[model samples]
Target: MAAPIDLELKKAFSELQVKMIDTQQKVKLADLQIDQLTRVQKHAKLTHTEITTLPDNTRLYEGVGRMFILQSKEEINNQLMDKQKTADEKIKELEQKKVYLERSVKEAEDNIREMLLSRRAQ
Candidate 1:
């Protein structure tokens, strides 16, 4: 009877340990994703600045060429802006998830500690 109870406790603890590890990995991945998104956002802003700073005639050929280039840049800028917004939103979501995972890990640790203390008291 005691052996079975000990085995069950060990299994539960092992499962909790795995979950804690998985949560830590997820948090790390989220951090990397946030960093990547930040870099992409910066790059987009820089490209937008370069496009806006181009001289009137120097950046594009006159006539139809000018209109085409201007239109292309506008479309690309819009797309980049959209991507940045999406990345920002994802980063925010990941941050929230990371916080929740951290809390869960803390709670799990506390539970394990409490269980051990109670076992010792018994």
Candidate 2:
């Protein structure tokens, strides 16, 4: 009886450890993606600011596939807005996912602690 219980407990611990590791990895990945998106959004905002400060009639060129194409100020502003919007959306989604992953990890840790306490009591 004791041997079987020990084996089961070990198995459970192994599984929980695996789950925690997986969740941690996922959280790290989400953090990295969020960081990248944030940088992109920041860059877009800065570029938009610079563009706004320029003369209205100043010629502007937008980059496309390693080449610059002449574009109007309005078009460039529109593109920057789009970029910011898209980055915001993606960052929001990743943040939500990170929350979920963190919750799962916390739950798994609690479960492991509960299991240990129960085994000790027994």
Every model's TM-score: 0.74, 0.90
lDDT (CA) per prediction:
0.78, 0.92
Give the 10-residue window scoring lowest on summed lDDT in candidate 1: 57-66
State the lDDT of candidate 2 residue by residue for 12-116, as single tens digits.
889988988888899899999999999999999999999999999999999889999999999999999999999999999999998998888788779878877
lDDT of 2: 0.92
| Best candidate (score: TM-score) | 2
Give the C-alpha lDDT of model 1: 0.78
lDDT of 1 at 74: 58
**Compared with the true structure, what per-residue lDDT tens digits does model 1 show for residues 9-67?**
79869988898899989989989988998898888788777766875444432235546
